[model samples]
Target: MTTRPLPEAAFRVLLSLIFLVSGATHLLRPEAVAARLDGAPFAHVATALAPSTSLVLLAGVALLAGGLALLVGYRTRAAALGLIAVLVPITLTVQLAPEALGPLFKNVAILGGLVFFAAHGSEGYSADRALRLRRARRLVPALS
Candidate 1:
């Protein structure tokens, strides 16, 4: 098999897999996902923000959209920010406990990855880079 040279793009796609799958699950199984919120650490606050179903749907949409963008490296920083928005509450409510140390650390690592995208923006093999290149090409042709 040929080796893939674009590590950043590969990392982004790898990181996005969980969000994509989880987002679909949230959207498709809102009731089941919402049930878990009943026992979550910040269930009251989460419900206070919105009814559990509505909250799940909102988070679902955010995660899916953000994951898609991240996977393609389009608006990556903004996408990371949006994922951060969804993840922070979920991490706080669902994964923050002594009994959940493994999941908690996993979420923390995901947060770190998201933060890197937020801080550094897109890498070379990204839609952002492609668009920027296209724009530059058009401008250069116009000037010539």
Candidate 2:
């Protein structure tokens, strides 16, 4: 059988993997994550919001869940949008420092990726497709 190509889905899955791994690392070692976040430019907002451990756990869980949703192509656009929303606060809070330019660039790149995915559904290899198809079928009878 010929395999259908899914470049968009693949790109999304790869980006999701990156988020998942980062989240897992933070969840597994809150202190380490805390230290890193503390040193970053956006530490002030994080510090103001919650304990370092709690922030790490919350961010980690969000990333993991969002990543999984993207990976499975389930509501992928919504998931991508959610991930972007979550990152915005962190990005603004932490990556504002001049010294944090490198990380800031990376975050910007990820943001762009999230936006791209948000606009384009995961094509054929996604739950969105099934849902869309169902909706289309439902409307067919009325139109006919």
Per-model C-alpha lDDT, please?
0.88, 0.83
Estimated TM-score for each candidate: 0.92, 0.82
Q: Candidate 2 lDDT, tens digit per residue, 26-141?
A: 78998998887788766776788888778889999998899999888889889999899778877887788888799889999999999977887577577777788899999999
Worst 10 residues of 2 by lDDT: 1-10
Best by lDDT: 1
How far off is residue 131 in model 1, in Å?
0.2
Model 1 gets an lDDT of: 0.88
lDDT of 1 by residue, 1-144 (tens): 222438777888999998999899999999999998877877887898889999899989989999999999999999999999999999898887688899899999999999988888776588988998899999997898
* Alpha-carbon deviation at 72 in model 1, angstroms: 0.8
The TM-score, computed over Cα atoms with residue i paired to residue i, of candidate 1 is 0.92
Off by over 4 Å in 2: 1-5, 134-144
Q: How well does candidate 2 score on lDDT at residue 19?
A: 85
